[model samples]
Target: VGRIKTAPACSHVPELPEVETCRRALAPRLAGRTLTDAVTPWPRAAATPLVVTGRCIVRLDRRGKFLLLRLDRGWLVIHLRMTGRLVVVRELPPRTTAAFQLDGDEWFCLVDVRKFGRAWQVARASEVVGHLGPEPLSRHFTAARFSAMLAPRRARLKPLLLNQRFLAGLGNIYVDESLHAARIHPLRTANTLSTGEVRRLHRYIRTILRAAITEGGTTIQNFAGPDGKPGRFRSRLQVFRRSGEACGGCGTIIERSVVAQRGTHFCPHCQRL
Candidate 1:
């Protein structure tokens, strides 16, 4: 096997919206198809390639930031950690980490410039995804439930929102965008948020995520859909990468700061401490 080269650390990793967009693009073409063969040029990219061959993909589902492909005998889970992408084509593209030959002469390819992607074949999907918190867009994630989840946590708002167990599917981008939309400071303590603030946060979280998905997810640099088209949501971003730009809500310039060890963007006048 040839050595697989990893891409540099990405500043804009795929959040829930991007992963969900990939799921949506892949489900129609992948569902009900059987994998006649599987190849992984990088062993590290796929955990159980042996189990992936010859299995029928019953469905494709998304949980938080993970993509779950329901196979006849087990589940095929994929996580595009950074710079990882799934594309379908007649011929596999360069930097292909893994490729699955579908029944209809189509190819489902995992290409990662950074080589940080992962794939797993498991007997139970829950084995991999059971620990994640509620899906933010699901009916189960009610405002009352969100308040209950935040009531006892003292962690900073941004990091707490990024926690998969606290609220699955949020990464730095959406957290910053959502926080700006709600006008809540990233450093605010979870337990310190007033009831109204918590409610507003909850509303904006879902709102921003849904809107991003509708726009096909945000593309900061290398992100693209299975069709290999850049996402339109990047054009709609208000603060994630708008550092030093005038705030959309207030005239104050957006500032960048480090929170949770990740570069964060917010408007000081809008998202005050």
Candidate 2:
């Protein structure tokens, strides 16, 4: 069997933009395609495995980082937590955790090295992603609504934004970029932001997400589209993984710190705590 192409193992998690990229790429290829068979080399990856044979794929959708395959009968929800990749190829790739055979001689494979990815077959998509917060790019996420959401939260900015229940689709990369653009410190209290700061933060968050999606998401470790292309947004990053690099806004050197138990990057001069 031809080995599946894999990226070197890294800690980067596929966030909203990366997941959206996969959804867009797979939607057209998978729409109306029937699942001929199901195989699970790592059975634990199928959180709610059910009979997927003969189920026609209606469409591909995404919520936060979960890719939703809308089948004729039920939904196939996939979450690529870390080092998990979804690729459609004619040949089976190595390290395939789960694979769905398609009628058109194509195989939809979930190639994972760390085995943290999960798949769920459920009657409703809500069974898997019901608890996720609002999509950052959706129209319902207005500036005023964002301000209201942050008014009562006492959690730190970095951890609060990382929480999927607070706001969906943002991971370390976009969060740092957005916070840097908004001039907010990652450790700042969420409720301490002024109205103007809140507005700036909300706007920057949306802007950065849209930009990343347009660029096919930032690929730090293993993120790639179904077409096997790495994200182009990594080159556009300002602070993430650029610890000693000079800040674009200010010449001050960028710094890295551990916040919310994740590596946080920021400009010491621009974002004052």
Candidate 3:
């Protein structure tokens, strides 16, 4: 199932809520001011220790829902799995779930997407290494890398998309949407893409992930943005959990099944293998 064995035993990855929670968590302190230190109360899961604590925060951005803490020494790349959340509590959440501290005044909580995916405590900014895949938008993660990633694996594309080591920050929501948008069968094997399809798939993957980040990701369950608000993207979904619902484009009923071991949705008519 492409599991990395982080902490918990859940069966999910960087779903929509975890990303949105991170955006809300650091917006207040990270927007205008600077981050002086990085604290990992949970050594096994939090990002790297502090680097640019007192300096001005250049910006806080999301790379596939992975919170990129752009600091002076490096980027504090935070990956929230099934239950990851970057909550900015005045002190602490007063609950047992109070996981770790990121900045001085801010606190980060790894909610655990099955507690599988882990936070890479990296020291280099924009320099991801070993076992990490290409950023969908980066110049390095070109059509070549995308093609190469699938060329060798026989795994299902849905699970492949969820693999951060292959492509970081992409989760179930974006994968489902990308498959639907590209009209490519999600269950197709890795080596099935043509040159044209690879380019289109590349564009759609970036496009879909970018759009979701703009929409703040989908909210199905207990996920709330960093400010603790519900996300609205779920209402705008085409085929995510809307089984038996008419396809937004072709009006065909959306179908649901297990793909790559995750609950997946698609329109049989609009998207064919």
Candidate 4:
């Protein structure tokens, strides 16, 4: 893998991989711990925050980009929007919108500069994430199902993939990267893809997401692991923000356009529209 000192400023909200990284780090530290207290400097950070106080955490789970803290009584669902960071530390970090007093002298904090992050206490996690479509990495999301699902959509591929109600856990970064890898143009209409193209797209979506999770996610902007490390996967990105650079596959300069109101990067030679 290549090495980069910092990620570019082009990436958007935390996707499945970034949220998953946070979940993996928090699960071990907080699974059995009781929520001693819940405090939010920003009042909008959590809804019914105190409801979770004194509840024992069952486990840390993630659906799409939301972190589900399964409590003995209810679920504490958190969505780390555009600029949310979940960290466990001895002292509260700067920009701490909300902090939970965890056992073992650690603090589970949501440090968000944008303040777009939100947490909720609910009887069912589906209250927040129930409408989301199938997880791309789940075994049940087979190519046949994906193909069938696409057959009815008339939307563009990039926008359709980014829609959580269609397929969960994808954001601008992964969708662009996956589409480029699958040799599918972002502006292509969903129902126009052939069976082989659908299969390839499905495979690359799963593969890229898994690899990104392994590298701690693509830190295009303010993302960082619970350990305070920027994602290594940025070094492996093919065409998300490499506009004006040579295409690795065909040596043609990569291009950029607006699709679904988001900046899209792709190789004109590799991903002909």
Best of the candidates, TM-score:
2
Q: Which pairs in model 4 have colliding backbones? A: none
Q: Candidate 1, which ten residues in sequence have the lowest lDDT sum?
A: 2-11
Residue 177 of model 1, lDDT score: 94
Clashing pairs in 1: 6-114, 7-114
Model 2: per-residue lDDT, tens digit, 1-273?
654432222224789998887788777778999999998899998897658989999999999989999999989999989888887777767888998999967888888988989999999999889999989999999999998899999999999999999999999999999999999999999999999999999999999999998998888875433336778899999999999999999989999999868999999989999
**Residue 170, model 4: Cα distance from true site in angstroms:** 0.4
**Stretches > 4 Å off in candidate 1:** 1-12, 222-227
Q: lDDT for each of the candidates? A: 0.84, 0.87, 0.62, 0.85
Each model's backbone clash number: 2, 0, 16, 0
RMSD of each: 4.6, 2.8, 7.5, 5.0
Would you give me the overall lDDT of model 1? Answer: 0.84
Instruction: Give the CA lDDT, 0 to 100, for residue 104 in model 3.
Output: 47
Tell me how far the alpha carbon of residue 198 in candidate 3 is from the true structure, in angstroms, after superposition: 2.1
Residue-wise lDDT of candidate 3 within 180-232, one digit each (tens)? 88887788776887777778889888776666556665667754333355555
**lDDT over C-alpha atoms for residue 272 of model 4:** 81
TM-score per candidate: 0.92, 0.94, 0.71, 0.93
Give lDDT: candidate 4, residue 249: 86
Error of 2 at 202 (Å): 0.5
Off-target runs (Cα >4 Å) in candidate 3 are: 1-28, 31-65, 68-77, 96-129, 224-227
